[model samples]
Target: MTDTFKHHLELLIACVIYGTVGIYMQQLEDMSIGSIIFYRIFFGLTALLFYLSITRNLGQLALKRKKKYLLLLGILYVLQMFSYYSAIR
Candidate 1:
């Protein structure tokens, strides 16, 4: 089906982008590893927020229902990233 083909194409492109992150990171050795990780998170968060806003999905997120869990999850993500960045460096 055409839908399956598009799904595969999307996965392929995601793979390419993920693969390219290594090359991009390799080019940024002069920057502090924290800076690199911060920039990555900042840009990714900004883009994700923008996409959600443009699609008017933020209003549908029901954050009030999961505020505590979401907050904990976010903290966990940051902590995990700190360790991951250290390992990557």
Candidate 2:
């Protein structure tokens, strides 16, 4: 496949995966919102690490600078996810 086709395919797959998150969350309505968010982040981080290992890009994760900024970004991301899941719940 050409690069354009491959990119589009990846985009489409990502969209499908993202679109199903709400359905999955709804199905797990019995679980606490914090538990749901934790599982989501855990699985997402696992998947990301797996992908990085497979693509031999693990070295890219090394923090060369701006440690404070990275921490801030992570905090923001957690807050965002918490708000998002809370809203959906």
Which candidate wins on TM-score? 2
Off by over 4 Å in 2: 51-57
Q: Which candidate is the best by lDDT?
A: 2
- Model 2 gets an lDDT of 0.89
lDDT of 1 by residue, 51-80 (tens): 999998987656668788889998898887
Alpha-carbon shift of residue 20 in model 2 (angstroms)? 0.8
Error of 2 at 58 (Å): 3.6
Model 1 residue pairs with clashes: none
Q: What are the RMSD figures for all models against the true structure? A: 2.7, 2.1
Candidate 2 displacement at residue 29 in angstroms: 1.2
Please identify model 1 stretches exceeding 4 Å from their true place.
64-89
Model 2, 1-89: lDDT tens digits are 99999999999999998768788887898998878878878998999999999999999999999999999998998898788888877
TM-score of 1: 0.68
Clashes of each: 0, 0
